[model samples]
Target: MSIEPAGHGIEADNALDRRFSGRNEAVPDEAHHDGRGRFYWFLIGMRGIFSLPALILMTSYLGFAAFALDVGLTRSEAVFIWALPAQMILVGTMAGGAHLAASFAAVTFSSIRMMPMVASVVPDMRNDKTPTIVLLALSHFIAITSWVFATQRLRHVPRPYRTSYFAGFAITLTSINTAIVGIGYGVVSAFPPVVAGALFMLTPVYFISSIWASARQPVVKIAFLFGIVLGPLFAVIEPQFDILYAGIGGGTVAYAIDRVRRRRHAAGGV
Candidate 1:
Protein backbone atom coordinates (compact mmCIF):
# COMPACT_ATOMS: atom_id res chain seq x y z
CA MET A 1 0.00 0.00 0.00
CA SER A 2 2.99 2.25 0.55
CA ILE A 3 6.25 2.78 -1.35
CA GLU A 4 9.74 3.27 0.03
CA PRO A 5 13.04 4.25 -1.51
CA ALA A 6 15.18 1.23 -2.46
CA GLY A 7 18.25 1.05 -0.27
CA HIS A 8 21.78 1.54 -1.62
CA GLY A 9 23.85 -0.75 0.64
CA ILE A 10 22.79 -4.05 2.16
CA GLU A 11 22.19 -3.48 5.83
CA ALA A 12 21.52 -5.77 8.75
CA ASP A 13 17.84 -5.13 9.44
CA ASN A 14 14.77 -6.99 10.67
CA ALA A 15 12.92 -5.91 7.50
CA LEU A 16 15.47 -7.73 5.37
CA ASP A 17 15.04 -10.81 7.56
CA ARG A 18 11.29 -10.71 7.07
CA ARG A 19 11.70 -10.25 3.32
CA PHE A 20 13.10 -13.82 3.09
CA SER A 21 10.29 -15.35 5.15
CA GLY A 22 7.11 -14.30 3.36
CA ARG A 23 5.03 -16.94 1.59
CA ASN A 24 5.47 -15.20 -1.78
CA GLU A 25 9.16 -14.55 -1.20
CA ALA A 26 11.11 -14.78 -4.47
CA VAL A 27 14.43 -15.99 -3.12
CA PRO A 28 15.21 -19.08 -0.99
CA ASP A 29 17.83 -17.68 1.32
CA GLU A 30 15.83 -14.63 2.37
CA ALA A 31 17.66 -14.78 5.67
CA HIS A 32 21.27 -15.50 4.67
CA HIS A 33 21.42 -13.86 1.23
CA ASP A 34 24.01 -16.29 -0.09
CA GLY A 35 23.89 -17.32 -3.79
CA ARG A 36 23.10 -20.84 -5.11
CA GLY A 37 25.43 -23.59 -6.39
CA ARG A 38 27.10 -23.74 -9.82
CA PHE A 39 25.06 -26.76 -10.98
CA TYR A 40 21.84 -25.04 -10.03
CA TRP A 41 23.06 -21.95 -11.81
CA PHE A 42 23.69 -24.10 -14.88
CA LEU A 43 20.11 -25.32 -14.88
CA ILE A 44 18.86 -21.80 -14.52
CA GLY A 45 21.06 -20.91 -17.45
CA MET A 46 19.09 -23.48 -19.49
CA ARG A 47 16.04 -21.24 -19.20
CA GLY A 48 18.03 -18.65 -21.07
CA ILE A 49 18.31 -21.06 -23.99
CA PHE A 50 14.51 -21.15 -24.14
CA SER A 51 14.68 -17.47 -25.05
CA LEU A 52 15.70 -18.48 -28.58
CA PRO A 53 12.21 -19.54 -29.63
CA ALA A 54 10.63 -16.44 -28.10
CA LEU A 55 13.16 -14.14 -29.74
CA ILE A 56 12.74 -15.88 -33.07
CA LEU A 57 9.04 -15.26 -32.78
CA MET A 58 9.72 -11.60 -32.06
CA THR A 59 11.88 -11.24 -35.15
CA SER A 60 8.84 -12.15 -37.22
CA TYR A 61 7.83 -8.49 -37.02
CA LEU A 62 10.84 -7.44 -39.02
CA GLY A 63 10.04 -10.16 -41.54
CA PHE A 64 6.47 -9.00 -41.84
CA ALA A 65 7.67 -5.42 -42.32
CA ALA A 66 10.05 -6.53 -45.03
CA PHE A 67 7.22 -8.40 -46.74
CA ALA A 68 5.15 -5.26 -46.64
CA LEU A 69 8.00 -3.34 -48.18
CA ASP A 70 8.46 -5.84 -51.00
CA VAL A 71 4.76 -5.58 -51.82
CA GLY A 72 5.19 -1.89 -52.72
CA LEU A 73 4.90 -0.21 -49.32
CA THR A 74 7.46 2.40 -48.26
CA ARG A 75 9.22 1.79 -44.91
CA SER A 76 7.72 4.90 -43.31
CA GLU A 77 4.38 4.26 -44.93
CA ALA A 78 4.16 0.73 -43.55
CA VAL A 79 5.41 1.72 -40.09
CA PHE A 80 3.03 4.67 -39.84
CA ILE A 81 0.01 2.54 -40.63
CA TRP A 82 0.86 -0.83 -39.09
CA ALA A 83 2.77 0.22 -36.02
CA LEU A 84 1.07 1.71 -32.96
CA PRO A 85 0.21 5.39 -33.33
CA ALA A 86 1.89 6.07 -30.00
CA GLN A 87 5.10 5.20 -31.79
CA MET A 88 4.39 7.75 -34.49
CA ILE A 89 3.33 10.31 -31.93
CA LEU A 90 6.59 9.76 -30.11
CA VAL A 91 8.55 10.31 -33.30
CA GLY A 92 6.57 13.39 -34.16
CA THR A 93 7.30 14.76 -30.71
CA MET A 94 11.02 14.34 -31.30
CA ALA A 95 11.26 17.58 -33.28
CA GLY A 96 11.48 16.06 -36.81
CA GLY A 97 14.48 13.78 -36.09
CA ALA A 98 14.83 10.09 -36.88
CA HIS A 99 12.16 7.78 -35.43
CA LEU A 100 14.97 5.96 -33.62
CA ALA A 101 14.58 8.60 -30.90
CA ALA A 102 11.10 7.28 -30.19
CA SER A 103 12.46 3.75 -30.13
CA PHE A 104 15.04 4.86 -27.56
CA ALA A 105 12.31 6.47 -25.47
CA ALA A 106 10.29 3.27 -25.44
CA VAL A 107 13.35 1.32 -24.34
CA THR A 108 13.99 3.87 -21.61
CA PHE A 109 10.43 3.42 -20.35
CA SER A 110 10.88 -0.34 -20.24
CA SER A 111 14.15 0.09 -18.36
CA ILE A 112 12.43 2.27 -15.79
CA ARG A 113 9.87 -0.45 -15.17
CA MET A 114 12.71 -2.97 -14.87
CA MET A 115 14.38 -1.12 -12.01
CA PRO A 116 12.26 -2.72 -9.30
CA MET A 117 13.31 -6.23 -10.30
CA VAL A 118 16.92 -5.14 -10.21
CA ALA A 119 16.34 -3.68 -6.77
CA SER A 120 14.89 -6.97 -5.55
CA VAL A 121 18.14 -8.77 -6.51
CA VAL A 122 20.50 -6.07 -5.31
CA PRO A 123 20.42 -7.12 -1.67
CA ASP A 124 21.64 -10.62 -2.47
CA MET A 125 24.78 -9.56 -4.28
CA ARG A 126 28.22 -9.88 -2.66
CA ASN A 127 28.87 -6.70 -0.66
CA ASP A 128 31.51 -5.32 -2.98
CA LYS A 129 31.52 -2.70 -5.74
CA THR A 130 32.63 -5.05 -8.53
CA PRO A 131 30.16 -7.82 -7.75
CA THR A 132 27.36 -5.34 -7.25
CA ILE A 133 28.03 -3.70 -10.61
CA VAL A 134 28.29 -7.08 -12.33
CA LEU A 135 25.01 -8.24 -10.83
CA LEU A 136 23.28 -4.96 -11.68
CA ALA A 137 24.48 -5.13 -15.27
CA LEU A 138 23.35 -8.74 -15.54
CA SER A 139 19.97 -7.82 -14.10
CA HIS A 140 19.01 -6.29 -17.48
CA PHE A 141 18.39 -9.83 -18.69
CA ILE A 142 15.70 -10.53 -16.09
CA ALA A 143 12.38 -10.66 -17.96
CA ILE A 144 8.93 -11.98 -17.09
CA THR A 145 9.92 -15.61 -17.67
CA SER A 146 13.00 -15.46 -15.48
CA TRP A 147 11.18 -13.43 -12.83
CA VAL A 148 8.30 -15.89 -12.71
CA PHE A 149 10.64 -18.87 -12.55
CA ALA A 150 12.78 -17.24 -9.92
CA THR A 151 9.84 -16.26 -7.75
CA GLN A 152 7.83 -19.46 -8.20
CA ARG A 153 10.41 -22.21 -8.64
CA LEU A 154 13.60 -20.98 -7.02
CA ARG A 155 12.17 -19.69 -3.74
CA HIS A 156 13.14 -22.90 -1.94
CA VAL A 157 16.82 -22.50 -2.74
CA PRO A 158 19.05 -20.79 -0.18
CA ARG A 159 19.04 -17.00 -0.34
CA PRO A 160 22.73 -16.85 -1.22
CA TYR A 161 22.14 -18.93 -4.35
CA ARG A 162 18.97 -17.30 -5.68
CA THR A 163 20.75 -14.26 -7.09
CA SER A 164 23.39 -16.38 -8.76
CA TYR A 165 20.78 -18.71 -10.24
CA PHE A 166 18.82 -15.74 -11.57
CA ALA A 167 21.99 -14.19 -12.94
CA GLY A 168 22.78 -17.38 -14.84
CA PHE A 169 19.24 -17.54 -16.17
CA ALA A 170 19.37 -13.90 -17.26
CA ILE A 171 22.80 -14.18 -18.90
CA THR A 172 21.80 -17.22 -20.95
CA LEU A 173 18.48 -15.69 -22.04
CA THR A 174 20.30 -12.52 -23.12
CA SER A 175 22.64 -14.60 -25.26
CA ILE A 176 19.65 -16.40 -26.77
CA ASN A 177 18.00 -13.09 -27.70
CA THR A 178 21.20 -11.77 -29.26
CA ALA A 179 21.66 -14.92 -31.33
CA ILE A 180 18.02 -15.12 -32.43
CA VAL A 181 17.91 -11.49 -33.59
CA GLY A 182 20.95 -12.01 -35.76
CA ILE A 183 19.65 -15.31 -37.13
CA GLY A 184 16.13 -14.04 -37.66
CA TYR A 185 17.33 -10.97 -39.56
CA GLY A 186 19.33 -13.18 -41.91
CA VAL A 187 16.59 -15.79 -42.21
CA VAL A 188 13.85 -13.30 -43.04
CA SER A 189 16.03 -11.74 -45.70
CA ALA A 190 16.67 -15.11 -47.34
CA PHE A 191 13.15 -16.58 -46.99
CA PRO A 192 10.12 -16.24 -49.25
CA PRO A 193 7.39 -13.68 -48.61
CA VAL A 194 4.83 -16.29 -47.56
CA VAL A 195 7.27 -17.89 -45.15
CA ALA A 196 8.15 -14.53 -43.68
CA GLY A 197 4.46 -13.70 -43.32
CA ALA A 198 3.89 -16.96 -41.44
CA LEU A 199 6.68 -16.10 -39.06
CA PHE A 200 4.91 -12.86 -38.09
CA MET A 201 2.23 -14.91 -36.34
CA LEU A 202 4.84 -15.85 -33.77
CA THR A 203 4.60 -12.47 -32.07
CA PRO A 204 0.85 -12.60 -31.57
CA VAL A 205 1.00 -16.24 -30.47
CA TYR A 206 3.73 -15.52 -27.96
CA PHE A 207 1.82 -12.55 -26.56
CA ILE A 208 -1.43 -14.50 -26.32
CA SER A 209 0.30 -17.34 -24.52
CA SER A 210 2.08 -15.01 -22.14
CA ILE A 211 -1.11 -13.12 -21.33
CA TRP A 212 -3.02 -16.35 -20.74
CA ALA A 213 -0.26 -17.76 -18.56
CA SER A 214 0.25 -14.59 -16.54
CA ALA A 215 -3.33 -13.52 -15.94
CA ARG A 216 -3.38 -14.51 -12.27
CA GLN A 217 -5.68 -12.00 -10.57
CA PRO A 218 -9.44 -12.04 -10.94
CA VAL A 219 -9.27 -8.40 -12.02
CA VAL A 220 -6.75 -9.24 -14.70
CA LYS A 221 -8.85 -12.17 -15.90
CA ILE A 222 -11.98 -10.12 -16.14
CA ALA A 223 -10.19 -7.24 -17.81
CA PHE A 224 -8.67 -9.58 -20.39
CA LEU A 225 -12.06 -11.16 -21.09
CA PHE A 226 -13.70 -7.81 -21.50
CA GLY A 227 -10.84 -6.50 -23.58
CA ILE A 228 -11.21 -9.37 -26.03
CA VAL A 229 -14.91 -8.70 -26.45
CA LEU A 230 -14.88 -4.91 -26.34
CA GLY A 231 -11.64 -4.28 -28.21
CA PRO A 232 -13.05 -4.81 -31.68
CA LEU A 233 -16.24 -2.95 -30.88
CA PHE A 234 -14.28 0.10 -29.80
CA ALA A 235 -11.88 -0.29 -32.72
CA VAL A 236 -14.82 0.06 -35.10
CA ILE A 237 -15.62 3.43 -33.61
CA GLU A 238 -12.05 4.67 -33.11
CA PRO A 239 -9.29 2.22 -33.83
CA GLN A 240 -6.48 4.00 -32.05
CA PHE A 241 -8.52 4.39 -28.86
CA ASP A 242 -9.70 0.79 -28.57
CA ILE A 243 -7.05 -0.39 -26.13
CA LEU A 244 -7.47 2.67 -23.92
CA TYR A 245 -11.25 2.28 -23.84
CA ALA A 246 -11.18 -1.44 -23.09
CA GLY A 247 -8.46 -1.14 -20.47
CA ILE A 248 -10.07 1.74 -18.62
CA GLY A 249 -13.61 0.42 -18.94
CA GLY A 250 -12.79 -3.15 -18.00
CA GLY A 251 -10.52 -2.03 -15.19
CA THR A 252 -13.28 0.11 -13.76
CA VAL A 253 -15.71 -2.81 -13.85
CA ALA A 254 -13.19 -5.13 -12.24
CA TYR A 255 -12.41 -2.64 -9.50
CA ALA A 256 -16.08 -2.16 -8.70
CA ILE A 257 -16.62 -5.91 -8.45
CA ASP A 258 -13.64 -6.30 -6.18
CA ARG A 259 -14.78 -3.45 -4.01
CA VAL A 260 -18.27 -4.90 -3.63
CA ARG A 261 -16.81 -8.35 -2.88
CA ARG A 262 -14.61 -6.90 -0.16
CA ARG A 263 -17.51 -5.05 1.37
CA ARG A 264 -19.72 -8.13 1.37
CA HIS A 265 -16.96 -10.22 2.91
CA ALA A 266 -16.41 -7.63 5.63
CA ALA A 267 -20.14 -7.50 6.42
CA GLY A 268 -20.30 -11.30 6.59
CA GLY A 269 -17.36 -11.30 9.04
CA VAL A 270 -15.70 -14.18 7.17
Candidate 2:
Protein backbone atom coordinates (compact mmCIF):
# COMPACT_ATOMS: atom_id res chain seq x y z
CA MET A 1 0.00 0.00 0.00
CA SER A 2 1.14 3.54 -0.76
CA ILE A 3 1.17 6.13 2.01
CA GLU A 4 0.21 9.74 1.32
CA PRO A 5 2.11 12.69 2.84
CA ALA A 6 0.69 14.70 5.79
CA GLY A 7 0.35 17.73 3.51
CA HIS A 8 -2.05 15.81 1.29
CA GLY A 9 -4.47 15.24 4.19
CA ILE A 10 -4.24 18.89 5.27
CA GLU A 11 -4.91 20.10 1.73
CA ALA A 12 -7.90 17.80 1.39
CA ASP A 13 -9.45 18.97 4.68
CA ASN A 14 -8.78 22.61 3.73
CA ALA A 15 -10.60 22.09 0.43
CA LEU A 16 -13.57 20.54 2.22
CA ASP A 17 -13.65 23.39 4.73
CA ARG A 18 -13.46 25.98 1.98
CA ARG A 19 -16.41 24.37 0.24
CA PHE A 20 -18.54 24.83 3.37
CA SER A 21 -17.32 28.38 4.15
CA GLY A 22 -18.50 29.82 0.83
CA ARG A 23 -22.19 30.57 0.11
CA ASN A 24 -24.11 29.75 -3.08
CA GLU A 25 -27.83 29.31 -3.74
CA ALA A 26 -27.75 27.85 -7.22
CA VAL A 27 -27.13 24.25 -8.17
CA PRO A 28 -25.52 23.72 -11.56
CA ASP A 29 -28.03 22.85 -14.30
CA GLU A 30 -25.68 20.33 -15.82
CA ALA A 31 -25.01 17.47 -13.46
CA HIS A 32 -25.89 13.79 -13.23
CA HIS A 33 -29.44 12.84 -14.42
CA ASP A 34 -31.36 10.31 -12.36
CA GLY A 35 -34.75 10.57 -14.18
CA ARG A 36 -36.87 11.36 -11.09
CA GLY A 37 -35.41 14.89 -11.15
CA ARG A 38 -34.33 17.16 -8.28
CA PHE A 39 -37.80 18.56 -7.63
CA TYR A 40 -39.32 15.09 -7.12
CA TRP A 41 -36.64 14.24 -4.57
CA PHE A 42 -37.18 17.62 -2.99
CA LEU A 43 -40.86 16.81 -2.55
CA ILE A 44 -39.91 13.48 -1.07
CA GLY A 45 -37.66 15.37 1.33
CA MET A 46 -40.47 17.72 2.30
CA ARG A 47 -42.61 14.68 3.05
CA GLY A 48 -39.90 13.42 5.41
CA ILE A 49 -39.86 16.68 7.41
CA PHE A 50 -42.78 15.42 9.47
CA SER A 51 -41.24 12.06 10.38
CA LEU A 52 -41.79 10.91 13.98
CA PRO A 53 -38.17 11.54 14.93
CA ALA A 54 -38.54 15.15 13.82
CA LEU A 55 -41.34 15.61 16.36
CA ILE A 56 -39.03 14.19 19.02
CA LEU A 57 -36.30 16.55 17.86
CA MET A 58 -38.67 19.51 18.23
CA THR A 59 -39.44 18.46 21.78
CA SER A 60 -35.74 18.35 22.55
CA TYR A 61 -35.21 21.83 21.13
CA LEU A 62 -38.27 23.00 23.04
CA GLY A 63 -36.68 21.73 26.20
CA PHE A 64 -33.41 23.46 25.33
CA ALA A 65 -35.16 26.77 24.78
CA ALA A 66 -36.87 26.56 28.14
CA PHE A 67 -33.59 25.63 29.74
CA ALA A 68 -31.94 28.64 28.20
CA LEU A 69 -34.63 30.89 29.58
CA ASP A 70 -34.32 29.31 33.01
CA VAL A 71 -30.65 30.15 32.93
CA GLY A 72 -31.57 33.80 32.31
CA LEU A 73 -31.06 34.26 28.60
CA THR A 74 -33.64 36.66 27.17
CA ARG A 75 -36.22 35.20 24.74
CA SER A 76 -34.39 36.71 21.78
CA GLU A 77 -31.01 35.45 22.99
CA ALA A 78 -32.37 31.95 23.45
CA VAL A 79 -33.67 32.00 19.89
CA PHE A 80 -30.39 33.40 18.67
CA ILE A 81 -28.49 30.52 20.27
CA TRP A 82 -30.63 28.08 18.33
CA ALA A 83 -29.47 29.66 15.08
CA LEU A 84 -25.85 28.72 15.77
CA PRO A 85 -24.48 25.23 15.07
CA ALA A 86 -22.53 25.08 18.34
CA GLN A 87 -25.42 24.14 20.62
CA MET A 88 -23.38 22.48 23.34
CA ILE A 89 -20.94 25.37 23.61
CA LEU A 90 -23.60 28.07 23.69
CA VAL A 91 -25.49 26.18 26.37
CA GLY A 92 -22.36 25.64 28.42
CA THR A 93 -21.26 29.23 28.15
CA MET A 94 -24.63 30.47 29.26
CA ALA A 95 -24.99 27.99 32.12
CA GLY A 96 -21.45 28.24 33.45
CA GLY A 97 -20.93 31.93 32.75
CA ALA A 98 -17.70 31.17 31.02
CA HIS A 99 -15.59 33.61 29.04
CA LEU A 100 -15.80 33.94 25.27
CA ALA A 101 -12.33 32.47 24.67
CA ALA A 102 -13.14 29.38 26.73
CA SER A 103 -16.46 28.93 24.99
CA PHE A 104 -14.75 29.24 21.62
CA ALA A 105 -12.19 26.59 22.53
CA ALA A 106 -14.85 24.19 23.79
CA VAL A 107 -17.03 24.74 20.72
CA THR A 108 -14.12 24.23 18.33
CA PHE A 109 -13.15 20.98 20.04
CA SER A 110 -16.70 19.66 20.02
CA SER A 111 -17.17 20.50 16.35
CA ILE A 112 -14.72 17.74 15.42
CA ARG A 113 -17.78 15.49 15.16
CA MET A 114 -19.09 17.49 12.22
CA MET A 115 -16.00 16.97 10.09
CA PRO A 116 -16.41 13.20 9.74
CA MET A 117 -20.17 13.54 9.43
CA VAL A 118 -19.91 15.94 6.48
CA ALA A 119 -17.24 13.87 4.79
CA SER A 120 -19.39 10.77 5.03
CA VAL A 121 -22.63 12.35 3.76
CA VAL A 122 -21.59 14.81 1.06
CA PRO A 123 -20.16 12.43 -1.55
CA ASP A 124 -23.50 10.62 -1.67
CA MET A 125 -25.34 13.91 -2.26
CA ARG A 126 -23.06 15.56 -4.80
CA ASN A 127 -21.15 14.35 -7.83
CA ASP A 128 -17.66 15.60 -8.75
CA LYS A 129 -19.10 18.41 -10.89
CA THR A 130 -21.62 19.73 -8.35
CA PRO A 131 -20.84 23.38 -7.62
CA THR A 132 -18.69 23.76 -4.51
CA ILE A 133 -20.91 26.58 -3.21
CA VAL A 134 -24.08 24.52 -3.49
CA LEU A 135 -22.33 21.65 -1.74
CA LEU A 136 -21.21 24.09 0.95
CA ALA A 137 -24.69 25.44 1.63
CA LEU A 138 -26.16 21.95 1.86
CA SER A 139 -23.40 20.89 4.25
CA HIS A 140 -24.27 23.77 6.62
CA PHE A 141 -27.71 22.21 7.06
CA ILE A 142 -26.12 19.06 8.40
CA ALA A 143 -26.41 18.80 12.16
CA ILE A 144 -26.91 15.58 14.12
CA THR A 145 -30.65 15.47 13.51
CA SER A 146 -30.60 16.10 9.78
CA TRP A 147 -27.48 14.00 9.27
CA VAL A 148 -29.24 10.94 10.67
CA PHE A 149 -32.29 11.52 8.48
CA ALA A 150 -30.23 12.25 5.36
CA THR A 151 -28.05 9.15 5.65
CA GLN A 152 -31.05 6.85 6.04
CA ARG A 153 -33.26 8.54 3.43
CA LEU A 154 -30.58 8.90 0.79
CA ARG A 155 -30.52 5.16 0.19
CA HIS A 156 -33.92 5.42 -1.53
CA VAL A 157 -33.41 8.86 -3.17
CA PRO A 158 -31.95 9.03 -6.64
CA ARG A 159 -28.36 10.29 -6.68
CA PRO A 160 -28.96 13.48 -8.68
CA TYR A 161 -31.69 14.83 -6.44
CA ARG A 162 -30.12 13.87 -3.12
CA THR A 163 -28.73 17.38 -2.61
CA SER A 164 -32.04 19.09 -3.19
CA TYR A 165 -33.85 16.55 -1.07
CA PHE A 166 -31.50 17.16 1.84
CA ALA A 167 -31.88 20.90 1.35
CA GLY A 168 -35.66 20.64 1.70
CA PHE A 169 -35.50 18.39 4.75
CA ALA A 170 -32.82 20.41 6.52
CA ILE A 171 -34.27 23.85 5.83
CA THR A 172 -37.74 22.81 6.92
CA LEU A 173 -36.47 21.25 10.11
CA THR A 174 -34.30 24.25 10.96
CA SER A 175 -37.10 26.72 10.34
CA ILE A 176 -39.59 24.83 12.51
CA ASN A 177 -37.12 24.25 15.34
CA THR A 178 -36.02 27.87 15.34
CA ALA A 179 -39.63 28.93 15.82
CA ILE A 180 -40.15 26.31 18.55
CA VAL A 181 -37.21 27.72 20.47
CA GLY A 182 -38.93 31.07 20.68
CA ILE A 183 -42.22 29.44 21.68
CA GLY A 184 -40.51 27.43 24.37
CA TYR A 185 -38.81 30.48 25.79
CA GLY A 186 -42.13 32.29 25.99
CA VAL A 187 -44.07 29.48 27.70
CA VAL A 188 -41.39 28.28 30.12
CA SER A 189 -42.28 30.86 32.75
CA ALA A 190 -45.75 29.37 33.10
CA PHE A 191 -44.44 25.96 34.16
CA PRO A 192 -43.25 25.00 37.65
CA PRO A 193 -39.51 25.11 38.34
CA VAL A 194 -39.28 21.31 38.64
CA VAL A 195 -41.01 20.82 35.31
CA ALA A 196 -38.78 23.40 33.73
CA GLY A 197 -35.74 21.51 35.02
CA ALA A 198 -36.98 18.29 33.49
CA LEU A 199 -37.47 20.09 30.24
CA PHE A 200 -33.85 21.18 30.41
CA MET A 201 -32.72 17.57 30.47
CA LEU A 202 -34.90 16.54 27.54
CA THR A 203 -32.56 17.36 24.66
CA PRO A 204 -29.55 15.47 26.02
CA VAL A 205 -31.67 12.44 26.85
CA TYR A 206 -33.17 12.44 23.38
CA PHE A 207 -29.74 12.73 21.79
CA ILE A 208 -28.42 9.72 23.68
CA SER A 209 -31.48 7.66 22.81
CA SER A 210 -31.15 8.58 19.15
CA ILE A 211 -27.52 7.47 19.07
CA TRP A 212 -28.38 4.18 20.76
CA ALA A 213 -31.14 3.46 18.28
CA SER A 214 -29.19 4.46 15.17
CA ALA A 215 -25.73 2.97 15.75
CA ARG A 216 -25.07 -0.12 13.60
CA GLN A 217 -21.29 -0.38 13.73
CA PRO A 218 -19.49 -1.92 16.69
CA VAL A 219 -16.87 0.81 16.88
CA VAL A 220 -19.47 3.57 16.96
CA LYS A 221 -21.41 1.73 19.66
CA ILE A 222 -18.24 1.31 21.66
CA ALA A 223 -17.33 4.98 21.32
CA PHE A 224 -20.80 6.02 22.45
CA LEU A 225 -20.64 3.74 25.49
CA PHE A 226 -17.29 5.14 26.44
CA GLY A 227 -18.62 8.66 26.09
CA ILE A 228 -21.59 7.88 28.31
CA VAL A 229 -19.42 6.41 31.06
CA LEU A 230 -16.64 8.98 30.88
CA GLY A 231 -18.85 12.00 30.49
CA PRO A 232 -19.99 12.30 34.09
CA LEU A 233 -16.57 11.46 35.42
CA PHE A 234 -14.92 14.16 33.40
CA ALA A 235 -17.66 16.65 34.15
CA VAL A 236 -16.89 16.23 37.80
CA ILE A 237 -13.16 16.47 37.23
CA GLU A 238 -13.34 19.53 34.96
CA PRO A 239 -16.77 20.94 34.33
CA GLN A 240 -15.92 23.25 31.44
CA PHE A 241 -13.84 20.72 29.48
CA ASP A 242 -15.93 17.61 30.12
CA ILE A 243 -17.20 17.20 26.57
CA LEU A 244 -13.83 17.87 25.02
CA TYR A 245 -12.15 15.23 27.13
CA ALA A 246 -14.88 12.63 26.80
CA GLY A 247 -15.06 12.98 23.02
CA ILE A 248 -11.34 12.70 22.44
CA GLY A 249 -10.78 9.95 24.97
CA GLY A 250 -13.80 7.92 23.95
CA GLY A 251 -13.14 8.19 20.22
CA THR A 252 -9.46 7.35 20.54
CA VAL A 253 -10.12 4.27 22.65
CA ALA A 254 -12.84 3.13 20.27
CA TYR A 255 -10.53 3.52 17.27
CA ALA A 256 -7.84 1.44 18.96
CA ILE A 257 -10.34 -1.29 19.78
CA ASP A 258 -11.63 -1.31 16.21
CA ARG A 259 -8.14 -1.54 14.78
CA VAL A 260 -7.28 -4.52 16.97
CA ARG A 261 -10.53 -6.26 16.14
CA ARG A 262 -9.86 -5.80 12.43
CA ARG A 263 -6.32 -7.11 12.74
CA ARG A 264 -7.44 -10.19 14.62
CA HIS A 265 -10.09 -10.89 12.03
CA ALA A 266 -7.57 -10.54 9.22
CA ALA A 267 -5.13 -12.89 10.92
CA GLY A 268 -7.82 -15.51 11.45
CA GLY A 269 -9.01 -15.19 7.89
CA VAL A 270 -5.49 -15.57 6.56
Candidate with the greatest TM-score versus the true structure: 2
lDDT of 1 by residue, 201-239 (tens): 665555444454444345655655776778788889877
Residue pairs clashing in model 2 are none
Distance from true location, Cα of 176 in model 1, Å: 2.4
Span of ten consecutive residues with least summed lDDT in model 1: 1-10
Once superposed on the true structure, which residue ranges of model 1 sit more than 4 Å away at CA?
A: 1-39, 51-139, 142-163, 226-253, 265-269
Instruction: Please identify model 2 stretches exceeding 4 Å from their true place.
Output: 1-36, 68-77, 83-112, 192-206
TM-score of each: 0.50, 0.69
Candidate 2 vs. true structure, TM-score: 0.69
